[model samples]
Target: MCVLKLKPAYKDYLWGGHRLVDRYNKEYDGEILAESWELSCHPDGKSVIAEGPWAGKTLEEYIRAEGKGILGENCRRFRDFPVLIKFIDAKQDLSIQVHPDNRYALKHEGQYGKTEMWYVVEAGPGAFLYYGFQREISREEFAQRIRDDTLTEVLHKVPVQKGDMLFIEAGTIHAIGKDILIAEIQQNSNVTYRVYDYGRVGKDGKKRDLHIEKALAVTNRVPLVRAKNSYPHVADCDYFTVDKLNLDGKMMDRMEGCVSEESFVSILVLDGEGTVACGKDGEQRVTYRKGDSLFLTAGSGRYVVEGRCDALVTTIRSQSAPVRIGIDIGGTNTKIGLVDVHHRLIDTVSIPTKTERDPEDVIADVGKAVQELLDLNHIPLDACMGAGVGMPGTVDRENGCVRYSNNIPWENVPLAEELGKILPVPVAVANDADCAALGEAVAGAGKDVSDMVMVTLGTGVGGGVILDGKIFSGRLTGGCELGHMAIYEGGELCTCGRRGCLEAYASATALIRDAKRAALADPDSLLWELCGGEIGKLDPEMVFAAAEQKDPAGMKLTDDYVRHLGTGIVNIVNLFRPEAVLLGGGISAQGTVLTDRLNSCLKAECFGGEHGQIPEVRTAKLGNLAGMIGAAALLVMEG
Candidate 1:
């Protein structure tokens, strides 16, 4: 058996997908024509880990730590490696969707969100893809068509053929139709603001959620048109630059480089075979085949991809300017702050999260909170950079819509568009965990590390990732969900309708629950007495106190808890092999009492202990304010 670390599997959504047949082989050698957006491949997992301790983990987990030893080392090096690669098999029509640009993402999705390209592997007769709206529809018209189910009348459809390519920028309304296979290279995120679907029913016979208002607000009506001859189009943006190359032979391309600046490249092989030749590496070439992609880290001089097939090449460019503010929203608070262009947080503030007693009342309350913050500071909305908020869960960040947030009563709420309507500024929204991870990466312990894992030890073990210095929000916002990760079979029950999850054993809530159980079973333990003679009164802090006092029962309880935590950590480390693992939330303050034991246990459980640099178990430097700081940082970078 291969002993390795485990990584979190957030959640996956099932959509209608078509099987693709390519020249590589037959059988499963087809594309997954995405009906709805499929995330969980980048800054999360582009490729699934099929075996080892990290088996079942997303690629994002493994990439975060840059292939460091499975969860036991804490080196400071951060590798800027892209963590996601996407596949689109256009067997049917996908919804007309658009992702926000980095500015839009940072403002609305709470992170950088755009810059994507497609490499066509196969196309059926007269296959076509949707790009932008056919014409600008009035807000009233857009809403009426959405109600009338005639959204297709307003979209522009472009014919696509084999070996064709397209570069999709943020704010562009686009979709993939039937009978084509593609490899989509994009910034790691699972945010999609779908404007229209073909009224397809789900397994339960319900139509997928649609956000017409938000989509119309941000969708580009006049997107760059592509035709039969649009095979090799290059799009250059402040956040990412992409070159779509349909190569029949070896192609040599020189990338613009700056003095002492590092550049990263991702070579995606959609069909055939190819190799990336580097001059500084002494003619060393990295080879790939169909459905294969490679992330080339910063190196000097020119590079060449000499191969037998066509491929898509993507590069990230450094932003030349700076923005000054970032904003983030969460279940309990709405936060705003200031940051520099390099994504550094300088200041922040937190306000109560809208009670959202009624789902309908939540959006306006949130907007009011944001406006109040700006008003109190006497900051002009136009003068400020950008705003980012963290919605509760499973949000469509691309269009700034809250698809569904269980804790809050929101269903297809147009959060970004609504905010923009009144704020006179850009707004981004993302899941809270994703925003926190962005914050930690930009300002906290992860500042210098590009690839790292941030897990919050709270009521639930929430997770976020920074891969290649960008937050990886998976498709459907289902990435880096550590709490739901299965650590044991037939274990404790989880809130996500599952059992044996890491959260069931390791969260602060879990600790309190177990402590209460221990107190009830023994009845003689000091925990009962400390809780004022009521077992129900026990909390996580009480357990922490008991452990600190060296109570035999408390020590045993903590050991069990820590062991489970260590196991989960081991699993994440083995999968991601990140440079470091930063533990956040109130529970992380347990300090060495927790870290020392957890680290020791992890070392015992990890692969190649002592030989490999162990991942450091450090508390988050930003504390509860991390989410706020991160949101602010995201907005500023985007603004």
Candidate 2:
């Protein structure tokens, strides 16, 4: 008999009480729904299910068959089950959140920060989903709002439908609306902060203990600029990626083997039903239906998906290059970095831009910037090859010129030429969005494979694209001006003179605008604490830091940003099926809360439709220096 034992997810709750405890053991003396840790253990203390007829065997018996027996190598978690699963039923709102990237976690958290997807099996009608908040709020205004109970005004309120799948990342501020049931798939770890609860009393008629300090340490409040719709992905690589197999009747999707390493594919049924056929000889088919998920182990070549409705498929494989860097240049700050190929940071530096009158003078100063950077690191100019710059205006990469500097007042200036004049090697200049994308591609999370997108959260939202291992410069407007994508028709006015662009709701500029507006309405908020009681004194960085500090106002602001972020990323994942989507910028620096929400949004918004492939979402590996390193990488590759 085939004996594969599926494990049940464990839950941890602060509001947990002993009603259920009485059924299991009388020794339990804790609050209802207190702390739940799900573990799958057979007799003899084995934690995982074995394979074949011996799959249910205890740990001792499985080990006894080390060299023989059906249990084999697949029976052990140490040998198999590369992914971990969990479920969280938050009776109250989680803190404004953050998570370290994989590299950071390996060094800090001891386990991978969770990037989970939630399936809302049950939620109250009119239940609101807390994703990200809108725009950057000044630190002072944020503080003030908490005192006045006006922080809720800043969040993106989405009425979640049952059966909705939502992806949440670490660093993103999210709260499970009152009364919700969820199914979660994520990197295995339980780390959370309680930013703000609805002030609801638990069954004990007492307030739940809040992790305010830890919550503040993690939140990103600059407002998240969510990504656009993702198109179907034709290829994928490790860490993880999903592809849409929209089949009306029968369709055969041929996957051409690229490298030598083995690969795994996962199929998720979003609608109707379908069967996945193996590429090898026997042509085995695995049948699945809506909400069903299956995996293909160590196989390559053409696989067919045939069904009544559409199906979404995902693949995970190993690849070279694990880092990517993203860069964004604003009017006030100029940043640079060196990152590993996988979106993880190696080194970084930032400086205030001279922002002098003449474009030439400002461009000429880049030489000094490079020299100063080199001197600081004690590295010779000859040792470095190239650099990437995210200019403030439209950039003509072909001619290395800034077509127009709407934000800084420059036109057709050779910013790259001036910087190159000082450097020993070459340099590439692009719009801030393109530069951010390249940074993500080279050293950010989407390192190994091509075809990916990056979003940078800043004073203004920016976007970039990578296709087939090269930056895709849109035929005329540069590649993927995602920030400009419309979220609401004729909603908020943007600096670009457009209405309801994603930037209007999710950028630092938007956050500040809303925060200031909220402060104007509520004068008693804690926001006044950070800004000396003056709304004008508010700063984006200050608000972001405060959010990490978990001030009520800060948490509210971050929560709003995360909600909008979820909506935007869902759209992007639906449009392009890239291997993975990465988030960067000042906002993403806060970490897991943002990443967790992003993963949740993908699952909630994904629909099998005619085609239903959803991509993986992750935070940028590099913190603030992705662009500088990515720019440098551009030179290295061109050289």
Candidate 3:
């Protein structure tokens, strides 16, 4: 049967007590029962099958016998079982330690790293755990504190209570405190670096080996920044997404869920008793209780859990989704991203532009980099649907050639033709701004609207108009040159040698230049403090930051920025009147600082005012890789 109860592997450590054996009904007779590997497949310890056809066999053995299809498509991406479930009963505090991230672990330990979530099944009064640092500290201080036994002073301590949950990602320094029982769901690996062990000796009469050097290298030295809203459920990472199932046996005592073909389901019961029935006829029934773990094969269809219980349900989300290659070419560097079918950038790599090199040589270097990326990911050429190129300057989409690009200093260069020689797949090329617009329209914030305009506020203000879900460049050439539109007659000189174009006043370059000029004028302003009186190092963000502090120069620069950029957007509204205007690039990082004021400005100054149907002004969802994703979307939209 697909649904089968499993037995746990026991662990006895120095700091552990008999809580697992006494309270949880573990079979272990040991005095110190530190951990129970409830749903594990690690080589060091594997849970054995307790019931059904695979009874008496290890989880690893059952998988080998039943074939990988039982594990589901999501498991296919992983070389082994991707999840490890354990019930940790700490009578004494766990050694202050950290786990390396995937890159570090794979290189040093030859395994994936740990990212775990702890559910406090039980906690003694006033129990607490260490989580990262209270504040950012220098490396020198961090080491000295460890040596002087003052590390706990800097550690961020979180009080524990039953039912509390904390996600501990790799590189986060943490430790489980005494008098706590934790159910940990993590990536299937055992690589920890103990930084401080409280001078505890092992059974061998020596202080346990501490991975101090490795811990120093991998530990995140700053305060932990938890990824906000990463998982609406219990916990989620690349390895697994865990959700809680609670049946109180009073009002709610049963739960019905479906197991799709994409991923298998693992249920680890922490409280109460229940009978889980699986399969089409619900013939497969398994009685579960506290400390019991059940595994259900993928595509097992329907399952029903009945009784009073609190359980952790773990599942993988994505399978082997098809990918597309996106190449975003810029002046200083070229970014290549592997965009999945969902339009998410699964991976990205960058190469220095080195524009001084010959065009062919530069193109060859990009080709080599793209190939290397594809190889590293174990993705074959044919696995990618196609390749898309987003170029900095005006591009002839029909011919896949960049007609002119001052950034690359290449004119009429056949970008697609050069890539086609190396990459054996269909290649599509378009202007980077247009690609950004298309990317947003197809997969980002503009995805909901068929008609939208994207304004990129970066080195130079760039815009692309999307009409009815497609990039509208107008009869092959002269269109969407948004920055060149003259905002003020006979004013600031633009890069195109025009007087007072939107780019001169609206771009980040313009902001930097204006901020530097303002800093020179207001010597005592926060702008001077921010750049340390070195006005040459002044950036656009410094100006906005100073404005936040009510500095005269910063406030004036920002106000003028709104006026000029707002004017350009108002013109766009009057011309096309799209459903939305998505603002992207580094300036957009200011978030609401740009959108709220610009929306106010657009609403007031537009031709129709309140009477007109104005577009919603929103931040672009795709951010920096918009060009790459959008360029890739062109092939899909056209195909």
- Which candidate number maximizes TM-score? 3
TM-score of 3: 0.62
Between candidates 1 and 3, the one scoring higher on TM-score is 3
Error of 3 at 570 (Å): 19
Prediction 2 global C-alpha lDDT: 0.57
User: Which portions of model 3 miss their true places by more than 4 Å?
Assistant: 52-55, 134-142, 228-230, 260-262, 319-326, 330-639
TM-score of each: 0.49, 0.44, 0.62
lDDT of 3 by residue, 398-437 (tens): 8889899977899989889998898878889989899989
Cα-lDDT of candidate 1? 0.64
Model 1: residues >4 Å from true position, as ranges? 1-325, 340-350, 357-361, 375-378, 635-639
Q: What lDDT score belongs to each candidate, Candidate 1 first?
A: 0.64, 0.57, 0.88
The alpha-carbon lDDT assigned to residue 498 of candidate 1 equals: 89
Residue-level lDDT of model 1, residues 1-639, one tens digit each, is: 111111222222234244533443222422342422222344433455444455676545654544432211111122233223556655566676888765566677665566577767678898898776776667677668777878677877889887666767667778888777776666656668887777787657798887766676666664343332322345554444566656665453332221112444555555676565654543545555665555444433465555565556656554433444455556676666655544555455666766556654555665666666666666555556666777667777778788877766577888778867666667777777877887787777776576778888988898887776667776654556777889998889988778999999999888988998888777667787678987778877788788778776677788898888888888888877776678887788887888888778768877778887677766678776667667655564332
Report the CA-based lDDT of candidate 3 relative to the real structure.
0.88
